[model samples]
Target chain A: MNLILLSPNDLLTDNRACIKNPRQLAHIKQVHGATVGDQLKVGLINGNLGIGLVTELNDTAIYLDVDLHQAPPRALPLTLVLGLPRPKMMRRILQTVATLGVKQLHLINSYRVEKSYWQTPFLEAENIREQLILGLEQGCDTHLPEVHLHKRFKPFVEDELPAIVADTRALVAHPYTETACPCQIEYSLTLAVGPEGGFIPYEIDLLEKCNFEAVQVGERIMRVETAVPYLLGRLF
Target chain B: MNLILLSPNDLLTDNRACIKNPRQLAHIKQVHGATVGDQLKVGLINGNLGIGLVTELNDTAIYLDVDLHQAPPRALPLTLVLGLPRPKMMRRILQTVATLGVKQLHLINSYRVEKSYWQTPFLEAENIREQLILGLEQGCDTHLPEVHLHKRFKPFVEDELPAIVADTRALVAHPYTETACPCQIEYSLTLAVGPEGGFIPYEIDLLEKCNFEAVQVGERIMRVETAVPYLLGRLF
Candidate 1:
C-alpha cells in the first residue's frame, strides 16, 4: 500500500488505534515492513491524508497514532462510461480508474458485451468496493469513485445520459471512427468505451445523440482494459 | 483469448493439432465457448493470422485443423523505454506494450526501483512469454516484442542510447515538466517512462544527453503501468 488508509471510526480513545485485521497487518508487515516509531503516510478513508506512527507492533497486530491535516486528494475531472468488460479485465479497470481518481464510472451494457458477464462474482457491490479501495491505497488517495451500473442502453441514453453529458465534453472511443482522439485535453471530459469488439453502429449513434463525439486512438485496436488507462492518460 | 496464438513449429505437422493444456482449454471453453465446426481467429506465433476449425473435443483435449495464410498484424512504429517498475506492475507493462504492438521495450534501472524487484518471478523468461502471449491474444497479433534489460543506466545511455535515438522522435514522460506530450504522432517514436517516484534529475539529464526530449502527459502524476498505455495513446 503506497498510503495506509484508515477510516474515521478506526481511531480509538486517546488518539490510539489497534489494527488486528489480517489484510491490513499483512500489508504493514509484508508490504511496508514497518517497525515501531516508523512514520508512514496515512489517509482517512474518504477523509484526509496524514502521517501514522507505528507505536506498537506484534505478530498478529499493529498500532498507530495518526495526525491528519491534509485534504483528500483531488479527483480527476473525468467520468468513464465503460461497456462492462470480462470479469478479469473489469478488475484491472476498476483498480486503474480508481487510482487515477475518476470522479465517477458507469458500467453500461453494449451489444458486444456478454449477458453472462453481468453475473460475474467480481461485479458484486462488495467486490467492486474492495477493488476501488485497493486503487485508492495505491494512489495515496482517500475519496472513492462512485460506480453505477446500467443494463439497458436505450433508457440510459435517452433518460440518464443527457444530463450526464450536459455540461461536460463527451467523447466515445470507436476503432473505425473518423475523428482522431485529441491529445491535450484541458477541460473536464466524459469518455465512453465499448466492449471487447467495441460499440456497434447503433450504439455509436445513440452515444452521438447524447453528445458524445466518436474518436479513435489509432488504427490498431486495444483491449478494453488497456483502453481505459489510455483514455484517462489522454483526457486527464 | 480473442485469438488463439500458435507457434510456427506447431504447424509443421499436417492434419490435426491437439491442445490438452489446462490454460488453453479453459480459455477455449470459458472465453470462446467453442464447439465442433466452430471457426475462430487464430494467429501463428511470429507469423500470420488464420482460421481454425475445431474438429473434435473430448474430456481432456481439443483438436483443430488450422489454415495459416493471412499475414500477421502490423506493429505500431513505437519503442518504449521504461524505468523498471515493481514486478507486479512490470507484468502489466510488458503485456500492455506488447498488446499495443510496440516494437521494443527497454527495462532500465532507476533510483526508485527496489533492488529486490529484479528477482521477481514474473521476470523469468517463461513468465514473460506467458504475459506476451496474453497480450498478443488480446490484440489478435502474432509478433512478439524484443525486451531489453539495462541494469547500468550510465553505460546504456552513453553507449547504446545514441544509436537507439538516431533518426527517431524520442520523448520521455515526466510530470511537472514544461512541454506537454504531443498528439498525432505519424512517424516512428520512442517513449521513456520512469519508475513509481519517477527518474531523478541526474537520470533525466543523462537521457537528455542521449537526445531524449522530456514531455509531460498532464499535471496529474500517473502510475507507471497507467502511463504506458496513456503515453502510447498520445503518441501513436
Candidate 2:
C-alpha cells in the first residue's frame, strides 16, 4: 500500500490509531519493511491526508500517532456509468476506477453482459469496499467511490440517468460515432462505456435520448479496462 | 475474441481454414454463436485483415471459407522501452501494448525492478506469444509486437539505446521532471516508463545521457498498466 489508509474504527485517541487488521499489518511489515519512527503516508477514509509516525510495529499490530492536515487530492469531476464486466474484469475495473479518482460509479447491465456476472460474489459491498481501499492506497487518496449497481438497463437509463446527465456533458464511447471524443475537458462529465461488442442499436438510441452524445476514441477498438483509463486521461 | 486470428497451420487451402483447437472452437460456438454461412471478422497472423465465412460447424472443428482482402490497421510509429513489470502485470502489459498497435517493445532492467521478475516463466517465448495472440484478436490487428529483453541496465542504455532513439522523440516518464508529456505527436517516439518506486537518479541521469528527455505524466501516481494506455492515448 502506498498510503496506510485508516478507518474511524481504528482510532484510539485524538491523534492515535491502531491497525489490528492483518492485511495492513502484513503490508507494513513486508512491503514497506517499516520500522518505528518512520513517517508513513497515512489518510483517513473520507477525511484528510497526512502522515502517521509509526510508534509501535509488531507482528500482530502497529500503533501510529496520526496527524491529518492536508486535503485529499481532488476527485475527478466525472461519473462513470459502465456495463457490468465479467467477474474477473469487474475486480480490476473497480480498483482502476477508484485509483483514477472516480467518486461515483454505476455498474449496470447491458445486452452482452452475462447473466452470471450479476451472480458474482465479488459485487458484495464488503468486497467492493476492499478493492476500492486498495485503489485509494495506490492512488494515495482518501475518498472512497460510491458504487451503485443496476441490474436492469431500461429502467435505470429511462428513470435515473437523465438527472445524472442533466448538468454534465453526457457521453458514450461508441466505435461507430462520427464525433471524436474531446480532450483536456475540465467540466463535469458523465461517460457511459459498454460491455464487449458494445451497446446494441436500440440501447444507443435510448442513451441518445437521455442526452449522451456518442464519441469515438479511435478506429481501434479497446477493451473496457484500457478504454477507461485512456478516455479519463484524455478528458482530464 | 472479437476477430478470429488464424495461424498459418490453420490454413487448409488458398481460401479455406479449419479451426480444430478447442479454444477457438468453443469461442465460436459459445461467444459468436456461429452457424454455417455466417461471416466473421478474421485476421491472419503477421498477414492480412479479412473475413472468414463459416462453411462447417460441428463438435470437433469449424471450417471457414476465407477471403483475404483488406490491409491491417497501421502500426504505431513508436518504440516502448519499459521496466520489466511484475510477472502478473507483465501478461496484461504485453496484451495491452499489442492491442494498442505497438509493434516494438523493449523490457529492460532497472534499479527498482525486482531481480526475480527477470526469472518469470511468463517471459518465455511461447507464453508471450499466447498473450499477444489474444491481444491481436481483441484489437482486430494482425501484426504482433516484437519484444526484446535486457537483463542489465547500464550496458543496454549505453550500448544499444542511442541507436534506437536516434531518429525518434525520446522520452522517459519521470515524476520529478519539469517537462510535461506532449500530446498528439505524429512523429516517431520512444517512451521509457519505470517500474514501481520508479527509476533511481543515477539511472535517470544515464538515460538523459542517452538523449531521452524526462517528461512528467501528472501529479497522481498510476500503476504501470494504467499508465501505459493512458500515455499512449495522449501521445497518439
Which one is best on lDDT? 2
Question: What DockQ values do the models have?
Answer: 0.40, 0.70
> Interface RMSD (Å), each candidate?
2.6, 1.1
Please tell me the interface RMSD, in Å, for model 1. Answer: 2.6
Task: Kindly give the stretch of ten consecutive residues in candidate 2 chain A with the minimal lDDT sum.
Answer: A216-225
List, residue by residue over B6-96, the lDDT tens digit for candidate 2. Answer: 9999999969999987999999999889999999999899999889999999999999999989899899999999999999898899999
lDDT of 2 at B110: 96
Candidate 1: CAPRI quality band: acceptable
Tens-place lDDT per residue, model 2, A111-202, is: 98999999999999999999999999988889999999999999999999999898999999999989988888879999999997799989
TM-score of each: 0.80, 0.97
Candidate 2 Cα lDDT to native? 0.91
Q: Compared to the true structure, candidate 1 yields what TM-score?
A: 0.80
Q: What are the Cα lDDT values of the candidates?
A: 0.82, 0.91
